[model samples]
Target: MRWPRQVMSLLVVLALLVGPPVALLTVVGPPITGWPTSGQLRAWVQQPLTEQTLTAALTIGAWLIWLMLAYTVALRVLVRLRSTSALLRRLPLPTPLQATASGMAGAAVFGITTNTAAAAPEHSPQPLAAGTTTLHDDAGPGGGESHTIADADGISVADGWIPRDVAMQVSAAASLVWLRRRRNYRPGLTPGDQPGSDLAPLPRTVASVQAALADNPAPPVAPSSYAITRLHDVLPASGIALTGEGALSVGRGLLVTTLLTTQSRPTASLIISNAALISLLGPAARRLIQRLPLTIVESLDEATHHGHPAERRQHTNGPRQAEDTPGVSGHPAVVILDEKDCDGGDLTHLADLSMGTAIIVLGRWPAGPTWHAASSGHLYDPHDLTVPKLRLCVLDHVAAADLLAVITPGEPALGATAAPVEASEPVRPNPRLPRQSTRYRSHLSAADTPRQRLHLRVLGDPQLLIDGEPLTVRRSAGLQILVYLAAVHPTGADAAQLTDAIWPGLPHHALTGRLYTALSDLRTSIRDACGLHVIDHADDRYRLNPAQLAVDLWHLNAALRHATTAITPSAEVWQAVVDAYPADFAEGRAWPWLDPIRETIRRRIIDVCAASAAAEPDPDRALSLLQAGIRIDPYNAALQERANRLLHVLNDDNTDTGIGSPYRR
Candidate 1:
């Protein structure tokens, strides 16, 4: 390829130099009287050349050679000086000095390629040969970043470097800079651009947390000031309160994340003694910690010692810190302390330090009056553990037992962990009575045992009655969870179903983890108090083990089923069903998940009452029963219709005034 190109270059040069002169002499020279014979022309060609003609041919050849030499020199200079301009840009210099250096570089490049002024007058321009030819050379930088030339009609080549690559690189750098500036600028809400200017957009995790809190029936109160706020609206001013040992274990992580996300100030800190609490909250809670700039201290000592020095200050009278006042910045530091078997003085000292903190003390409320005073909204009391004020949670006793079984290894757990005590009573025998139906009677006397079998009453406020002693399930979620599981018992429920029923709006990832934690808390509380594993699991589904479980709701449901199908249900059976359902299903829960079951059970109760009244021998007894049924469900058209018919019959012995209507109105 190279040889061919060189041959072409030589031919082009020779044609330019020789073709013109031959053309002029042969075609345009003075015309002869007649055309010369071939012998004559050959003789003329053979004759010696004249000095003028020889000079003209030599001069033309010399110009062609000079042009070729100039082209070769220009190409070589461009190749050798490829990196010189780039190197000059990198040197450190003042702006003015750098500009001067750049100008000098340009002058030097032009000086190398152009003929000197002194040599300009030595040669004059020659008329180029006829016809157009274009040439280009790509011999420069290794990359596509190279110089190119476009020569047309044999015109002289353009001078100086036209750096295509360097210009593109500069434009790209400018575009990146503009994009970076645009990305960093954000709009603010306040004209002054203060700390809360934009009021930080609420994180999506808040929705999951909100859903988790809603699992309980108790209403959470957000302060008037926070009514319009994002995350704060879902949070209570008093923070979340957990009473039972099980509830504390389950609700701690959820509470921590809630407090962190909805903190009054962006820079609030989270201080707790339990690292396991964070682990229990699951990946979603952990992710919340990452998104918020809150710091978590595992120990109070760390909070005191490792906290920002500026946060702690000394006053002559006492140590005055911002934490002394609750809601100082409209939010308190979330502090969870484990006080089981802890020293009283240490508890008091920590309490004093945590005055402004949303303190959740996980342990039995101290024995005496002074310690009892410690059991405020912030304190977690085993005896008085009630439904958490802010959030809803649901757990069944059996499922709770399984959960407790899982977290037992982490005993005394982070949030609601209690020290396990030795069972003082001896084991007792539970006698089996003759069964009247498929399901056995709920009552069976315990012959002295270390622990009593649990009796859960979910008809009203769910209560775990052991040995005639009713245990308080302070957490609303705790009771709700038990009720939901019982409502869907025997067949059991998968995690997704339970999550939807309990914490309905939680993100899927967070829902499962929260559900497990809640379940574990239930199991732990039951086990710690009653020493029973009431809940069982198989194939990722949770159900109450009938062998080890006894729920009043179950017994009530059984009685209701038997009464509806029995050929002649005795007054005793109907009475038993009525007694079992002392209140509506999951009374006070009123959750959307509980509504359907609640209505069904209500209708069934009405059915039993209405049918019982129809079969009564005495009109007064019949009227009383019908009236009670109507009282239970005023909207049940059947009960209302039955009561109306019974009243008409009682009023007139002979006349048939009864009318049937299906609608409630």
Candidate 2:
């Protein structure tokens, strides 16, 4: 049933459309005496030649079958839809909570009730079960070590407090605050990773989670979501790896140079955990929510300790970043301590550190990079595949530890009491990524000689650069910012000049550091290879050492040189120009410099195509060249319109039969 996946959708549609029509056809008809009226009031029940009876019986069966089929098809279609959350959100608010709230509201509405016991949800602040963690936590692992029990039954403080059910929904909404689609990947399962099995290497927390789902004996339920809500029982493992970019061979599709390596402009990653509910909400719901201007930020500033009533009660009013952390941090921020005593009252201490905030989560960690984690509170060794750099970020995503858990998955998470990491000690750099800092993240690898010049490839729209080896970058804008400097006659373009060139409307101060980071990457890639200053700022000139680098633009310069001045044109010259054209100038970065290169190469490609078609008369080759040229200049009326109209001239000239030459086949 290798149906293009599209056919499954089509089949469902067909069943829905055809089944109802068949039901209607069976019902709408001229009746032949109408089923014989139960054999004339039970007198002629033995009669066999009754057309009306048979017809009516067939109709009834047909309608029933049609209804069943339609119902089945509709169900299948709904299940396959990308968003399905809205349909199932009809569950009633909790009965217990609803009853309690109704009772309280009734007292106010009717004015006939005695003083009520403090309403529920006013002060009943329970803790997560032992050995569990979820994103809702404001401080690091609370209870310091373990939460103390305070009989919370019948606990209340306010006259009119929110219902428990409403509170639960509000808490759940907090989880959805910084929602983003998370990519789940496991390393060993990737083709060609078997030999590395049992390495016990550390990956990012997100990667750990991905590996968990991948290696799980049970089938995965869904992709791209936060794990199950019951955090204590079934914590979805996250992996650890350094953050950056890599080219996926993805069967045959490769994005080599489109500058995708440097993540420049990032799109919003929305995670719809309840797909069914999200589907029902649709774009309209998203717009409405965006318009709401919800200020539901939970502050982490000035939050010192955990599990203290004052700390917890007053905790909601802290720094905006703290409250905002849960929304965007991409995982739960939990603080772990030894105990809830005043000394480590994870709550009070949490308050001081918070500086008047709850939680501020504004990083692009996908439930974050990984650390050593437990499956069922036991040491769970993970297979090694996640690149090492992104791991620490992963663990920090979920665990609210005093210090980050930076070890592999099986290793025990280091607690706050562990020896302090010396500020002077050099950090062990990320293994998955080369040690390149933001200082030069955006410059091009300045190759010192023609031999070191990297090759350029066009996978689709954008072309990627490979200087002896592929380069990895974290931000696309950084890559673009780097490439412009790289592509420029690298005598480094001034910061002001480059900014205006790349982003005409953007202010200098806002993008200067970011652009500087991208150049640093280019600088590092160049340093690692050809050992040259890719971009240097001196005497107000942003210059690239041409000795250290070569680009498609320069190659095109050579091709044009060979084509325009050669007394007699050769196939090699035309081929050189054709080879120089890259599908995309910058893979992921959208900047102004790319536009000129795109159009320039585009016209040059057309010139080569037309020249090749004229110089060589093979129809297949000519057609291919022309078609390639046409792709870029589809609306060009001059070349195509003139050539097609001069078809007779082209047919008659066999030696130079291009699109409209005077030559015949």
Q: Rate the local accuracy (lDDT) of all candidates.
A: 0.45, 0.36
Query: Model 1: what TM-score?
Result: 0.34
After the best TM-score superposition of candidate 2, give how far the Cα of residue 619 lies from its true spot, in angstroms.
8.5
Query: What TM-score would every model get versus the actual structure?
Result: 0.34, 0.30
List runs of model 2 lying over 4 Å from the truth. Answer: 1-467, 486-491, 521-532, 582-584, 587-589, 611-625, 646-665
Error of 2 at 557 (Å): 1.8
Off by over 4 Å in 1: 1-451, 653-665
10 residues in a row with least lDDT, candidate 2: 250-259
